[model samples]
Target: MTKLLLINAGSSSLKWQLVNMPAEHVIAAGQVERLNLPGTIVKVEVGHQKTKEVVETLDEIAAIDRVLKRLITVGGVQTLDEVEAVGHRVVAGGTLFKGPIKLTPSRIDQLRGLSELAPLHNPLEVKCIELLAQRLSGVPQYAVFDSAYFQGLPEKTAIYGIPYDWTKKYQIRRYGEHGISHQYLANRAAEMLKRPLSELNLITMHLGSGASITAVKNGQPFDTSMGLTPVTGVMMGTRSGDVDPTIVPYLMKRLGMETPEVVIQELNASSGLLGVSGVSSDMRDLHDAAKSNQRAKLAMDMFVNQVVKLVGGYYTEIGGADALVFAGGIGEKDPVIRQSIIDGLGVLGIKINQKLNEADHTGFLEAQDSRAKVMLIPTNEELAMARDVQRLMDAEK
Candidate 1:
């Protein structure tokens, strides 16, 4: 079995997993939180034991060095050389990459060019790749793109009602994000139902801080909620999911903002749950405030409504769904959110067992007579990345 290190770097944090491939067993998994800031915390989990430490780091390179040292101290590996290869989760591959590929100097340069498409995610991912390549030396590195899964979206579904010449010139089309998680959910749903993936139709919800819903037809991505960027999906922690296009120019004129970027910054950084409730972006916080705050309650209601609307549309687009699969942070843990969204779909005859829904489990939670199965599958994007890494590595042989 080969050992692979999977790296998923976000704007402010770095999540890594060391795994034994082929067997698909995790050796260790953890994250470095609050990078390049004070109170940087390194958290590691090996089997059932977990450890946390504070390291003084001013950048991702320093943060990565600390992670490698901790791996040895925790006995995750005897030496860094044990890690045969590395795989990175790149948020936006654009049209340049249709699938995962080995990371080379040229490929890295191409990824940097796409940074404009995923300003919040791809730049940091590229930085991590460069750091790992230098630190790990000759070890092979691969990039697993989140957008690659939806690269096959139908033209009608992907294109905006804009000028055709503009789309061809600017590449302005729906390129869904969180595709890694959504793809994993679809594969897992197939396993749970014991159905061939090619025969299944699913609506997979990836509701994290950045949320999105994907319509899977015959085991492939048919349509998704996220547009050209991740900020266009269903309501997220801070992003204003879907707003009128004219709002950008209107906000700029009214606020005396010179650039559209200024208005977009607010939509991306200050909107959504935090903007609506004027409270924390977290769902748990929203739940607590909803007991007494009307705005908080409104935010929660709006979130559920948006999710249900998208799911309903996708359900119809796919003709019907065999299963409504839930994954990601909010999808897997928050039973209340799950119930609220599923309840909104009652018109479609989707129902879940209250007892099973409230329980802490990962499987079918659908009621006996519900028209479609409701699955609660925790996403495993790292494992998915490792599998891709293994595939590409073996291909080179």
Candidate 2:
């Protein structure tokens, strides 16, 4: 049956999808949550059914083993060799990569070095690649990156207004995060709108636990909110996006802090919705508490407000956008937040049909084209990875 498994390795959670290779029908998908911690949970959704199990602490490699074992023993796969290819989500391809790469020893090591740029994501990604290669043996492994598509960004848009020579030495530029989701959303959104990608201008938002906004025009990325790091965009579940460059020196002088790295970690992991709301990072929990909780409401307001502001900025940057699309966990399900962001854009020809926005028919929410088309696309990044894998494998064939 030529099965392919796609892996998305987070800081502590590992998400996986097993699909019929070229056919792209998902056989099963699941998440190993809280890896390397006590009470780790393994949740799997097979054939539209879900089951979850909690186990004792297991290392990341152990978690991967357990998942593969479940797919074979518990999920009724006769042979592991049926898995034709494995795909990993590599977060910081930064200029070094622009698309998926078939894993080789050299390529794997290069990705490891890039981890310095995205400490929270790349190391884990490289580990997934390592673990998969160790366990799956002969299967071809591929890597799809989060910073890849943005590598083609215009030179002017990429180079910050700084000492231009430093850009040459450091190679620091806007290597936008969520490249996979945003890129997939941009293309899928074009398809749903029934327009050729080259003719469309879109503001694609990946509003998940972590979020970023991208400005796609003429089938290419024109600009994006994220910069050299994922921590540069709109406020996220726990990131301090777009802080003043001056804050570093001020904090250092005032508090006698050790280094900028320490403060930056706080910005990366300790801020955002969690910091503002003083609640759990999960949006569902925040939404439930927001009714009477003043701070929670304020946090949600800040999140929606920031997204709207970024959309406005990108709309102006791209001259004018034809449509605005949302994807990711929050973007797909949170209709109230979607409507809130689009409410002020009526004059700009962007208004969400309330019924279309509210109706959550299980998976994806494709809204009506009232003024500017509003679509709530549930991003299938694994499908995108599988498509890339097919393309690469075809070249070999």
Candidate 3:
């Protein structure tokens, strides 16, 4: 059995899964949260066994070292040599990288240079890649990007109104995030609808803490809510999306701020649901508090409003969709949010069945005779990365 390691390194966390290829079954999975901070949490699951720990990791390398140790001890791996290949999830490939590629030294340098594009993600991902190169020198490693699926977007939608020279010199364009999840969703929705992907149109919603919607036409990305960065889309757990461009400079002067970086940090970390609710960044917590809290209710209302507007706009952009598919954390589990959004889309003749929405693991939520089908799909980005790795490896042979 070929053991493949899939790593998704975030700004403050790292998630990994070890899958047995050919079988395509997960052997073990784990994540380390709050890296380089006190009270770091690590969790691992293998077979029927699971373990959680609180250990301090001084940096990303130490976090990785802890992960490898847990993988061997709790995950049943005798040694790191058992893993035949590693796949790293890179958040921002910019325009330079459109697809998954082997991580050669020169390519790694290119990835490092693109760090300015995705400060929150690419640096840590590159650090993890470097660590893998050091500890497992012979293993073949791949960089699977999150923005790759949106490369073929229409020119009008990808380009901004900025000066042409600056746009070209700085590579300014809409490089949408969450492409791996969106790509998996488009294919799975086609399968569920019993239609060829090339013949189906879809509006796929990935609504976790970091949310984005995609208008997919015939298996390709037509338009997405996220722009050049993940912070440009609808409101998210902590990100303030779709803010006025002038707000940066205005806030700098108004708030007595000194730098653009400080303003950007506030938008990225201090805003979003947390800012609106003044409670928590988690939707579940917001939902629980909404019954008595006005701010929480308002936050929920704003989030649902954003989702409904995006769906309606994309529906028109795609010339009407065959189905509106929902994935990600809240989409799959939170029926209230789903119902609220569907209610807002009554103009489109979309109706939701209460029984179906309440059912666990239910995919079809649209009522009979509704104008379009509504589907709920659990995203499998790790599987998508694994499949891409397998494809690239096969092509090389």
Candidate 4:
């Protein structure tokens, strides 16, 4: 009875799933949110039952400890020893790691060096990995990187237009984020279309708080919106994406900012929909405010325009896409936003079945006679991590 535990940890949230290997059944899944704060919540589901509680946790380590204890108390597993291996979702592997690899002291140090590449994500993830190692001392662990899937991008697409020497010396190429979601969607799209992934051209859009779009050529990532970090893609909930580099110095001089850090912080935390709308960063809230406020309407319009522009450009770059996939929060739930994006692409022979989109048809939202197919495929990055872990384990035998 082999079991694999998968973890995806952020600064304030820790999501975990315990799976039965070979069978691939998730025996237990859970999450702890709002860590290191009052009124923190812990939610867990085992088999047919579910539980939620307000718990105290100092940080991600404490949250993880609580989760493992719950697994034992709920009889999801008799003991922690039942777990044979653990899989961790690492956000940035940088140049050292291009795929899933076994966790080790040296490799962990290598990941630490790349922390500057993903300042907001990697440090927290590393802390989780370290804590997990102490708790499950003997269990083998694997790091499945989100950047691994995009490592195969062509040189022309990956290189930045910086000084050639600086690019080579600093490794300053585009290391696109959200590769896990994009990779999962590519294969899922192939399965639904009844075609081999290797033969399909896909444009996968992951539109959440931190959003990115990927151009998958023949099932591999050919290009992506994110560069160097997740903050360079299309406009996100709070992130100022695709900003002109010169704006940094301009803002510094005009606003009396002391350094670039101050300007960058504003772009990361205060810009995007929040700055433009002067309301909420959430799409739902933005839509509600757009009904009454001009700025909110402009923010929503700008978002839709950016999405359409990227999709259109990718469609052309990829020599016309066979399918356009929508995932993540805004892409899956908000039908109005989805419809607006599709309507914007009507000039490219892409049409949506307004009735079907509004009526909750399964995945296919495109009109019957549309030239290109549009699909609603939900992404499961944890499952992707688990699958990669099992694959690496199988190779060991």
Candidate 5:
């Protein structure tokens, strides 16, 4: 049983898990929140026991050091050497990386080159990899890409209606993100239904601060909502998803912005729920404000409407769906959002058991007479990363 450390370094947070492979038993799991900010908190859980600490500093290197030390304190490991390998969840692999690969200096440089493709995620992921490499010394590290799963998207689905020459020269095509979560949901859905993944047609929704929906046809990624980058998917916490392309240029001129990056930054950071409602980016906040604020109510409505529209299109694109799987922060926990989206999808005869939908668990939520199954599957991207690492390790052996 190899011990593997799975790392998912986000823009401002770090989530990690230490697990025994083959058995897949989690030794410990934790995260560092408010990174690089005041009141940085580190939380760790071993079994049912949880611990939290307020640390003074948490730059990348310091964060890595703290996690290792906490692991020993929490009895997750006697020494750092107990960890046989490390796996990182890299957001964008582009077309260059189709699967998990051992991280070498050259490979790290290659990944860094794709930073522009995932500016918010890749650079940070690479930094974490480099930091871990120094701290762990000879321990093997692997990168499991989130975009790898969508590499198989059909050409027609991936290509934009742009000039072929430009598309070819710029690699401007749909390369969906959150693929790690989406792929995990699809596999879990297959296990729950007791069916071969190859035989299932699924629509997986990953709705969180960053949201995306994917269509799985016969076990493969058929299509997805995120395009070229994560910013193009359904409405997210702060991202303005699926806006008119002209809006960028129009905003630049209208707002007297010097560059397109300024407008893009607003789209990625100031729009969505926050932009529409002028409230907090969090869904819970929107729910509260929606009670009295029309803009907040509209924001919530727009989110549900966008999700339903994408699900409907994917359903038709896949001929029909066997199950609509929900996974991610809002998708797995928010019954109200789930019900609203499902209610909007009523035209397709999809219905969920209200009692089951409101339950605090993961499983089938579809009503008995519903045409297709509606499932709530909690995504385990870390486990998926660990599995990929194990697969690569076994292959090397």
Candidate 6:
């Protein structure tokens, strides 16, 4: 079995997993979050072992150094060669990227070119790849981008009617994100439902700090709400989703803002649940405080409303869905919120068995009597990445 390492490398932090393939078993997983801060935290959880390391000044280089050290010294990955390959969760594939590409010098340049599409992410991921390749020169790496799977999306569904010249020149269009999670969950939901992937119409909601919704028909993405950026879909942790175009110039003129760049930054970084509640980005915190905090209650209401609207739209877009799958931190775990979302979908003939739904401990989180199922199938992006890596490795062999 070839062991694979998967990385979700960001500009400031890195989330990684090492899995034993063929078995698709996780050997270790960890995250280095809150980059370049005095209270920077590196967390590694393996089986029953969990450790958190806090540092004062955690830059990217230093963060990677600490992660590599832990992988070798603590996590039992003794050598670089012990791992057969690496897979990255690249955020933007644009139209230029269609499928997984072997990480190469030329591909690095291509990824750099795609940086204009994801100014915050692709560049950082490319940096991580460069550093890793330099340090482990002989090892192979591959990019399993969030936008690549959406390539199967219909041209009519993908293209926005705009000036042909503007789109041609700027490559501007909806390049969806969270595709890896959606693809993984869609297949998982099919399996859980004992239905073929092609036979099911599914709506998958990835509702973590950063959220996205997708409409999957016949196993492929039919439509997704997320646009050229992750900041365009349902309300997210700090991102304001689906703002009017006029808001940009309005802020620019009203606030005496010089450039749209900073305003864009504000939209992506300073809005959403955190902005609404003046509370934490976490839904759990908001939910807990909802009893007493008006802001928290309002935040949850807005978040749930956005999700309800998205689910409703997707149901209409896909004609009707057989299953509505929830993944990500919030979607998989938040029962109260899940109930609220599903309760609103009563018109679709979906019902949650209070007993079975609450007792959903296994892969299925559905009410036994419900016609249309609502599931809490945990998203396994690493397993999907490893499967892709396994296929690629076999192809090479």
lDDT-wise, the better of 2 and 4 is: 4
CA lDDT of each candidate?
0.88, 0.81, 0.87, 0.86, 0.89, 0.80
- TM-scores of all models? 0.91, 0.90, 0.90, 0.89, 0.92, 0.89
Task: Give one digit per residue, the lDDT tens place, for model 5 in 131-182.
Answer: 8888899999999999999888999999999999999999999999988989
In the range 104-129, model 4's lDDT, one tens digit per residue, is 99998888889877766788788888
**Whole-model lDDT, candidate 1?**
0.88
- What ranges in model 2 sit over 4 Å off? 11-13, 32-43, 52-63, 73-76, 361-370
List ranges where model 5 is wrong by over 4 Å: 11-13, 32-43, 51-66
Give the Cα-based TM-score of candidate 2 against the true structure. Answer: 0.90
Cα-lDDT of candidate 4 = 0.86
Instruction: Compose the digit string of candidate 1's lDDT tens values, residues 21-48.
Output: 8899999998886565566778999999
What is the C-alpha lDDT profile of model 6 across 214-293, one tens digit per residue?
A: 99987889988888777888887778888887999999999999999889888877788878988766677788888899
Q: Which stretch of 10 consecutive residues in model 6 shows the poorest summed lDDT?
A: 356-365
Residue-level error in angstroms, candidate 1, position 227: 0.9
Which wins on TM-score, candidate 3 or candidate 4? 3
Q: What is candidate 2's local distance difference test score?
A: 0.81
CA RMSD of all predictions: 2.6, 2.8, 2.7, 2.9, 2.5, 2.9
Q: Rate residue 392 of model 5 by lDDT.
A: 95
